[model samples]
Structures are given as C-alpha cells and as structure tokens.
Target: MDSIQRKKLVNELISLIEKGNAHVSFKESVTGLPSELRTIIPENLPYSIWQLVEHIRIAQKDIVDFSSSAGSESLAWPDDYWVEPTDTVTDEDWNNSLQQIEKDQQRFQALLEDEQHDLFAPLPWGTGQSLLREAMLIADHNAYHTAEIVVARRLLKSWK
Candidate 1:
C-alpha cells in the first residue's frame, strides 16, 4: 500500500486497539478472579496477575518513550533477566496504568499516522515488527493477560 494508505490503515487499526483496551478494566476484568486463584502457582508459574501487569506496563512505557524519542538511548535488558512475581500493586494502579496505555497507544498511532513507514519500524526491544505490528502485539498481550485475570477470578469464586 502507498504511504498515505498505510497511514490510514494503521490509524484505523490503532484506533480500534486503543478503544478496545479502554473497555477492559482490571477490577471488572478480574471479576472472575478469586483471592485463591491469584495466589495459586500450581506448577510454579513464573507470572501472576501482578507480574503480568508489571511487564505490560514496562513494555507500553518503553514503546511510548521510543516512539517520541527515537534517538534516545534504548532500554537495556536486565542483567539478571529474572522477573519477580511478588511485586506489590493496588488494583487501582493497574487500572490507571491500562488507561494510560490506551492513551499512549493512541498517541503512538497518531505519530505513526504522521510519519513515514520507517517511523513505526521495529527495534530490538521486542516484536521486531513494524510499529503497527507492535501495537497489535500490545493489544494481543493485554487480551491474553486480562484473560488470565479472569481465569484467576473465576477460580477464586469471585465472579458474579
């Protein structure tokens, strides 16, 4: 597709993703997760709802930063490369963060709409696909983890 067409298509999909993620709230989304479910590690899963949110937040923030300042030093990988699942966070923090993510996603989309295809090109951070590719990945990531939260809630008998 031509550059203008690409921009329009990218913007359309980005709008859908931004809007789609807006409706998903950590609390209501986790309506199915019970206290017990949140704590279970049946097979010693490396991540919990807490950990997942932490990872996603870090990722989204990184993307926004990268989008705005392509010349800034990129985020470096952790030397330890170990993710801790016990991070403490309030449900409110998670929801607010997600809302911010929606905003960031929209901004990134707008920027993409205004720049050349190379603007959205992928970097080494992750999802070495185009910006549009990474945005969709973000949407998929949110859906995947939000679904996990729902599973935890239902397992806890917290769902109505």
Candidate 2:
C-alpha cells in the first residue's frame, strides 16, 4: 500500500481497537460496572468480571511486549494468561489493571503510528509474525473478553 493508504488503514485499525465494530465498544462494555459486583461469577461463566479484566490485562501486555520484540516465545498457556480464581477484587487491583490496559493500548497505538517500523514486515525470530497480525490479535482478544464481561454483568444484573 502507498503511504497515504497505509496511514489510513493504520488509523482505522486503531479506531476499531478503541471503538469496536458492530458490537458494544470496549469502553461501553467495561465502564460503569459496579466495583462490588466485579468478582461475582454468574451462572455458566467460568470467570468473574474482575477475572476477565485481569486476564485481558495480562494477555494484552504479553502481546504488546511480543510485538515490540523479535522473540517468539509464547506465554505459558492458561497459566500466565489467567489469575487465580478469587472471590474478591480489591479497588487497587481493579483500578491498576484497567490503567495498565489503557497504557498498553496507547503503546500499541504508538507502535502502529511509528514511522520507523513496517507493520507488514515479518519478525526475524518468528516463523511468520508481524505487527499487523499482533495488533489485530490484541483487538480481537480484548473485544471477545470484553463482551464476556458484559454478558456476565448482564446476567448478574450489575450492568443495565
């Protein structure tokens, strides 16, 4: 793609990451949830809303870190990605996790916006990995889990 086209596409990807598409945006899905209800696991869901938030926070950080490096090592599956099941989430943990998510998201955006890196170029340490693919993965992963949180909240009547 030409420079103009690349710029537009990058901006669009960032926008989709932020606002979502044809579904509830992450901001709308996650915000306004009662802190007290964050740890309540409704029927059928394996993870509480706080657990979901923490999972996203952990996974997103891993992805962002991976994207910036040439290393191909994956985080320990299901272990590093999730926290221990808990009945309560402290205000500090909850707030810190969300803030980390926001900060990492901005870093991802900056990675895309950086003129020095080529989004489509394959990383040397990987079989075939690129920033473009990683960005989409993070966005899709977050959106899916954010929706899960929304559903759990709805089931628990914590989100209206």
Candidate 3:
C-alpha cells in the first residue's frame, strides 16, 4: 500500500484502540460503577485478571517479536497461566500486571514509525498479514475483553 494510505489506516486503528482503553481502565467516563470492582478478575475463577493480563501481554510481546524476527510463535502457557487468585494475590501483583500491559501497549505503538508504519504488510515470518493488521487484531482483542470485564462486573455486582 502507498504511504498515505497506510498512514490513514494506522490512524484509524489507533483511534479504535484508544476507545477500547477507555473502557478497560478508565471507568470515570461511565456514570458510575456497580459498587465493587477489582482491577483484576475475582478470586473464584481459575484465572484472575492478572493471569489473563500476563497471557495477553505475552501474546503481544510475541507478535512484536515475530514481526521483527519472523516465524516465531508463542511458547506453551506456564502452569501459572491457568491459575486464579491462589488465596493471596497482593496489590502489587495486580499493579505489576497492569503495568506490564501498559508497557506492552507502548511497545506495540512504538513499532509504528514515520515510514511505512501504517500499511498491513505481510509478516516477515508468518503465513500472511501486515504488521498493522496484527496490531489491529490486538487492539480489537483488548477492547473486546475490556467490554467483557465491564459486563461481567455489572453482572456480578463487582463494580464499585
């Protein structure tokens, strides 16, 4: 794709990502929360929000790596990948997980440079797809989960 065309596409995708992020962590825009909300998922499920964050973060990191190195794929999920609250998840643990998410997001954004940054070129090592398309998928995936969290919190009366 031409440079101008790519730039436009990238910008549009980025806008979608921004909107998704608002739902994920910025509850202020909403009228109010349900009364109880944990930044991470609850303790009962097999996977707390933190573990999910790790899984997603790892996925994005792999995307960037694959984009650059080509042909690489995700490793097996660690035993902890399926874990839930474990009875003792600290505040720092949650904060650290969220921080990791932010860091991964930034890394994905940085891949967009002034040149050819917007085009969906085929991955260097993958079957087919440009970097921008991969990024778009990531953004959409994030937004979907963010919205899910909102709905789940509402259903569980976990938003506060």
Candidate 4:
C-alpha cells in the first residue's frame, strides 16, 4: 500500500479505538465514575465498572502484546481476561488499570503507525491473524465493554 493509504488507515483505526463517533469512547464511559459505584455490580449484570475496566485493560494489553511480538505469551481465555468475582478494587488498583489501558492503547497505535509492520499481512506466529484484524478486534472488544460500563453506570443512576 502507498504511504498515503497507510496513513489514512492508521488514522481511521486510531479514531475507531479512541473516539466516540457512534458510541461512548472508553474514556468517556469510565471517567468521573463515583468511587463507591465502581465496585457495585448492577442487578443482572455480570461485572462492575471496575471489573470491566480491568478486563478491558487485560484484554487490550494481551492483543497489543500478541500483535507486536512473535514470542508473546497468550493469556488463558475468560479467566485471565477478567477479574475474579470476589476481588476488590481499591483506588490505586482502579487508577493503575485505567492508566495501563491508555498506555497500552497508545502502544497499539504506535504499532499501527510504524511502517515496518504490514497491517494486512498475517503474523507468522499466529494462525491467520493480521495486524488489521487485531486492530478491529481491539476496537470492537473495547467498544462492547465500554458500552457495558455506561449501561452499568446508568443502571446505578450514576451516568449523566
């Protein structure tokens, strides 16, 4: 692909992951959540805001790690991606998880922007997954859970 096309694709992928064009961005969904409500599981929901945030961080970090390195280790599905039901999130834990999410997302964006990486070419270490596919997966997965955070906030009467 030409430089111009690569630049455009990078921009679009970044926007999809970072912006709230059609739905709430991850930052928008998590910001200003009350401390008390972060751990409160809304009725019928499987996760709280804190749990969702941690899950997003873990999953996104895994994807970024896997996409950027051939020797990257995969986390166990479901269990490794989510916080335990009985776990408690302190202020430090919450802040750390949020910060890591932002940092790792920036890492993923850098990988996308780097000219050395081929967005469409499959990683030799994986089955048939490419950087492009992983980018879309990150965007989709984060968006899905971010929406859940918003809904949980709404259910708790915390969202604006």
Candidate 5:
C-alpha cells in the first residue's frame, strides 16, 4: 500500500479503538461509574463492571505484547483474561486498572503508527496473524465489552 493509504488505515484503526464513532468508547463507558456498582453483577449477567474492565485490560495487554514481540508467551485463555469476583474494589485498584488500559492502548497505537511494523505482514511467531488483524481484534473486543459495561450500568441504574 502507498504511504497515504497506510496512514489513513492507521488513523481509522486508532479511531475505531479510541473513539465512539458508532458506539460508546471504553473510557466513556466506564467513566464516572460509581464505585459501589463496580463489583455488582446485575441479574443474569455473568460479569461485573470491574471484571469487564480488568478483562479488557488483560486481554488488550496480551495482544499488544504478542504483536510487539516474537515468541511472547500467551496467557491462558478464559482464566488469564478475566479477574475473579471480588467484593473489595478500592479506588486504587480501579484507577490502576483504568490507567493500565489507557497505557497499553497507547502502546498498541504506537506500534500501529510505527512504519517499521508491517500492518499486513504476518507475525513470525503467530499462525498467520498480522498486525492489521490484531488491531481489528482489539477494536472489536473492546467495543463488545464496552457495550456490555454500558448495559450493566443501565441495569444498575448508574448510566448517564
């Protein structure tokens, strides 16, 4: 692809991951969430806001790490991607998780923006996964969970 096209694609991926073009962004979904509601699992829902937030963080970090390096160790599926149910979600823990999510997101964006990384080339250590594919995965996964967070907030009457 030409430089112009690559730049445009990078910009679009960044927007999809960071902006609420068609749906709520992760930050917007979790912003101003009441601490009391962070750990409460709404009726019939399998996860709390805290769990979703942590899962997003963990999963995104794993993808970024895997994409940035060859032969990086992959986390165990399901178990490593999610946090256990906890009754004690302090402000510190909550803020740290949020900060990590933002940090790792920026890290992945940097990788995307770097010209050295070929967006379409498959990773040497992966099964034909390209940076472009991982970028889309991150955007899709985050969007799905962010919507869930919004739904949970609505059910808990904390949305808006």
Candidate 6:
C-alpha cells in the first residue's frame, strides 16, 4: 500500500485495538468489573473472567514480542499463552494483567505508527509474518476473548 493507505490502515487498526469502534471495545468489556467477579466461573464455561483476561494479556504480549526484531523463537502455545484457572485470584493480578494489555496495545500501535518501519515486511525472525499481520491478529484475538469476558460477566449478572 502507499503511504497514505498505510497510515489509514494503521489508524483504523489502532482504533480497533483501543475502542473496538464497530463492536464492543475491550475497555467496554472489562471496565467497571467488580474484583470479586473477576474469578467467577459461570456454569459450563471452561475459564473464568480472570483466566480470559490473563490469556488475552499473555497472547497480546506474545504478538507484540514477535512483531519486534528481538522476539523469541520458541514460544509454547497453550502452555505459554494461558494461566491456570483459580478460585482465588488477587486484585493485583487482575490489575496487572489489564495494565499489561494496555501497555502492549500501545506498543503495537507504536510499531504501526513508526514511519521508518515497513509494516508489510516480514520480521527477520519469522518465516512469513509482517507487523501488519500481527497487529490484525492481536485485534482479532482480543476482540474474541473480550467478547467471552463480556458474555461471562453477563451470565453471572456482574455486567451492568
């Protein structure tokens, strides 16, 4: 794409990352959540809200890491991407996970916004992956899991 098209695409992806403009945004999904409800596992659901949050954070962090030149080579999927579900998760853990997600979203946006970098070029460490691909992946993955959190919260009547 040309310079203008690239900027427009990056800006669109950034908006998706931060606000989920056309759908329920991540912030909208997680905002105003009660600490007590964070770990609640509603019936039939495989993971709690906290697990989903941590998973999103972990996955997003991995995407950010992989987008950079220094990203690690051996990342274990499922094991590395998810934390064990628990009955007693601390508020600090929840807060830190959300903070990390926000931090990494900013990091991803920075990569997209850096005009010096070629967004379409594959990372040196990867076979065929570009920053643009990763940014889209992060946005897609976050939206899916954030929707899970929102539904879980609604099932438990914790979201209002």
| CA RMSD of each candidate after superposition | 5.0, 1.4, 4.5, 1.1, 0.8, 1.4
Full ranking by lDDT? 5, 4, 2, 6, 1, 3
lDDT string, candidate 5, 1-160, tens digits: 9889999999999999898589988989988888999999999999999999999999999999999898678899888899999987999999999999999889999999999989999999999999999999999999999999999999999998
Cα RMSD of predicted structure 5:
0.8
lDDT of 4 by residue, 5-35 (tens): 9999999999999985699899999888888
> Which candidate leads in lDDT?
5
Per-residue error for 28 in candidate 2, Å, reads 1.6
Candidate 3: tens digits of C-alpha lDDT, residues 1-160 = 6777767766766666555644554222122532224434554543444444555666656666666565566566565233444445556765576666667666666676446443456765578877777778777666655655555465556555
Model 4 CA deviation exceeding 4 Å by range: 86-88
lDDT of 3 at 8: 78
How would you encode candidate 2's per-residue C-alpha lDDT over 20-101 as one tens digit per residue?
8868877787788887788887988899888888899999998888887766368899898998778788888888988999
Backbone collision count in every prediction? 8, 0, 10, 0, 0, 0
For candidate 1, the per-residue lDDT at 86 reads: 53
- Runs in model 5 deviating more than 4 A are none
TM-score of each: 0.60, 0.94, 0.69, 0.96, 0.97, 0.93
- lDDT (10s digit) by residue, model 1, range 1-160: 6777776777666755554545564435654444344434434344666555555666666666665564645666752222465535556765676677567766777666765446456665544656666667666766666666656555545556
TM-score of candidate 4 versus the correct structure, residues matched by position:
0.96
Relative to the true structure, candidate 1 has a C-alpha RMSD (angstroms) of 5.0
- Quantify all predictions' global Cα lDDT against the true fold: 0.59, 0.86, 0.57, 0.91, 0.93, 0.85
Candidate with more favorable, higher lDDT: 2 or 4: 4
Worst 10 residues of 3 by lDDT: 26-35
In candidate 6, position 92 carries an lDDT of 82
Model 3's TM-score against the true structure: 0.69
How far off is residue 54 in model 2, in Å? 0.8
Q: On lDDT, who's better, 1 or 6?
A: 6
Instruction: Looking at model 2, report the run of 10 residues with the lowest lDDT sum.
Output: 65-74
